[model samples]
Target: MSEIGITCTGAAVVNAIFNATGRRVRDLPITLHKLL
Candidate 1:
């Protein structure tokens, strides 16, 4: 059997935001202000 690690919701959101806005965030806790 194979085991997988936990997924990071913050990373996913940051990636999505980066892809859409071309902004790379290197901070923790992705907030609405960061995205804007």
Candidate 2:
């Protein structure tokens, strides 16, 4: 994917996690520690 598309996908993943768990993650690569 293009750069913008990749960024959007990453943002979407972060948003999904926030919506599901009510946690705001501000890091890239979405580590397991961030999930917990």
| Model 2 lDDT per residue over 1-36, tens place | 488887699889999999999999998879889888
How far out, in Å, is residue 16 in model 2? 0.3
TM-score for each model: 0.55, 0.72
Full-model lDDT, candidate 2: 0.88
* Model 2, C-alpha of 5: deviation from truth (Å): 2.1
Backbone Cα, N, C clashes tallied per candidate: 0, 0
The segments of candidate 2 whose C-alpha lies over 4 angstroms from its true place after superposition are: none
lDDT of 1 by residue, 1-36 (tens): 122333566678778889988988889777778767
Q: Model 1: runs farther than 4 Å from truth? A: 1-7, 31-36
Error of 2 at 4 (Å): 3.2
Candidate 1, 12: how far from true, in Å? 0.1
